[model samples]
Target: MSETYYLHLNVSRFELSLNGSLGQSVNITNGSDPNAANIYPDISYSLLTVLLLIMIATVAGNGIVLIAFCASRRLKTPFNYYICNLALADFLVGIIAMPGFIVYNLFNEVWPAGTALCTIWMYFDWHMTFESAINLAAVSLDRYWSVRWPVSYKRHTSVKRTILILLATWLYMHIAFFPGYLYDRIVNVYGEHDCFWDLVMNRRFCTAVAVLGYYIPLSVMVFCNWSIGSMVVKRTNATAQDPDVAKKYAEGETRLTLAKDKARRQRQPLITLAMITVCAVICWAPWVIYFTIAPHYPTALPDILITVGYWMCYLNSTINPYLYIATSDDFRGAIRDLFCRRSGQTLSGAFSMIISAAPKRTSLETSVRRAS
Candidate 1:
């Protein structure tokens, strides 16, 4: 049986372990706690099963998205590159971050890994998670502009520009986040069990990075979606009342039908982006609210915030690939083709086939599905 130390677990962006009992400061030094006598029995390995299942699902879903992106030329759209990057971030979280985190919680929140690994996980967890949110925001903004200005978008949109934008996001996020994080991890030395997260000490700096990484991006997603939504509504109203457009469609005008089809295509990507925004808001809002409010009432908040709320954020990562891919026929077809190729049920020669079979896209990548 594991030792019951009656400590409330505090899982945040940086910190992911049990601290002292509420209102009681747990000593982080070499010595054991003076008051380890409370017998709270709820801290158990019961969560391991749930957590592990989620971790597996998270990995498998994102893995398929990555594999599909690589294998299918259909998914080579411009903004979809951003989706690919988001999948990479989420995949890292599922593969690299979640396993160690599960081990941390499994062993009563005392980290099972070395201090070095713990510090790395601490950074990877926040950075990748934040990176995903920002990527979605960037895609939403890009899609909005493309929808708003279809004529100019054709001239400007390209795979190279998409790659450049993704690079810029990675650079900007690292610059905004890593320097301060590196400073804290280097300066504040702690014990084997202690993964030092000086969020309380570095509140302003942490909160600013959080804003830059998450909250601002969140606002941008909302604004972009709203703008796109309003434009689509106006266009729909204008088209519905126009007798000329209706008559052309009725009279089998090939050009008019093609134009209408193109317009329908433009609206589809926004729908996908909007769906992602809804999922992000639902999954992230709890963790975001909890983290912002928890520091103030560290002693008073419920234990479930760390367990349930944090998992909700991770759920955001798990849900992203499926949500985005499921909506797009290209992604769906790509994923279907991928599984069919692997339908032989053999790992033998699979890697070679994947490597050798990957095709390069030579055409200019347009804006999202409906953008062209």
Candidate 2:
């Protein structure tokens, strides 16, 4: 007997038949409404507008951070190196991930791109996301070292070393995410062209990815920030009790004044770290938790919850640069100076004002330069 397959498509349903002799059939109903798979037209239009705005803001905000870092030589310290890289990762997310995501959402969760494009899209999606997470952890560790060790932090963390660490983080992320890519390329059996992850089917791999990309880095960041906070409190108390420290600074009139100034400087970096940690948790934790648990109860999770999780994670990229601007006078001043020069303002005057107001170089930087 000859074997044959038949495909059937109708306005309200889809069907497939294998082996005309054996008569195996599968039917999928398209439901009573033609627009069932699509979001409500008005809602779709509104969401499209909102997502477009988010995409634009993500790109513009991260672009400004990259530009500000590049334009200001003073911002080129080892710590800001991590910030620069984080900005770059977020910039890539804005450019590579956001637009496709917008299309995906607009199309009602359908993947318009073919398999090859889908694979590439998924790779970049994880790559940029993991890069941002690891970069945030790196920033937390850098701040911790600076606050805890101060003098030796500079000597140990040189520009070359920082570059090496950044490269390693990027490399590690690629390696960590390689298994998912490999699975998609080799083991994916789904004939339907879709860009979304099938978390229910790929439970083990997704769990591994979540642990490596989210939980591990989040733990590290929390630990480092906690240690840094403790150190800051101890240091502030010690400085408050030491009158000689005020005499040494020359700018401080009393121990209380010196302690307050030191606390202020220390608080800035901690605030920056805290914001990064909090945002990461707020944006990523829900997604991770949902994905990890949703695999076990696939039918119980709603489609809208998945969409919310994804967009919340995407919002992280949009919000990071603003955090830098809010917590960092240096970053703010750098952006201002960059804009001023771009708009044909006198650089000398702007630079002089910024330099006057800027804090002195950290002990880490001073030591790094001396060693160099």
lDDT of 1 by residue, 1-372 (tens): 334334343332122246333654454322364323332235555676788888988999999899899988878899779889999999999987788777766655666467879888988887887788888888988998798998788899899999999988888788768877887787766655665465665565767776787789899999999999998899889978998876677766787778878876766788789998999889988777766766566656676777676678788888888887778877888888888778755565787789789985544553343465
After TM-score superposition, what is the CA distance of residue 16 in candidate 2 from its true location, in Å? Answer: 14
Lowest lDDT block of 10, candidate 2:
9-18
Give Cα-based local distance difference scores for all models. Answer: 0.78, 0.79
lDDT of 2 by residue, 1-372 (tens): 654555443322224233454444444335874323422223466777888899889889989999999889988888788888998998888888888887776655666577887777777777899999988888888888887888999678888899999998998787777777678667867644367667876777887887888888889999998888788788769977998875776764576676667768668867987988889888996688687778788877676787788888889999998998899888999998888777665667788899999999999999999999
The TM-scores, one per candidate, come to 0.78, 0.78
lDDT of 1: 0.78
Position 2, candidate 1: lDDT:
38
In model 1, where is the ten-residue run with the lowest total lDDT? 7-16
The list of candidate 1 runs beyond 4 A from truth reads: 1-46, 253-261, 344-372
For this target, which candidate reaches the highest lDDT against the unseen true structure? Answer: 2
lDDT of 2: 0.79
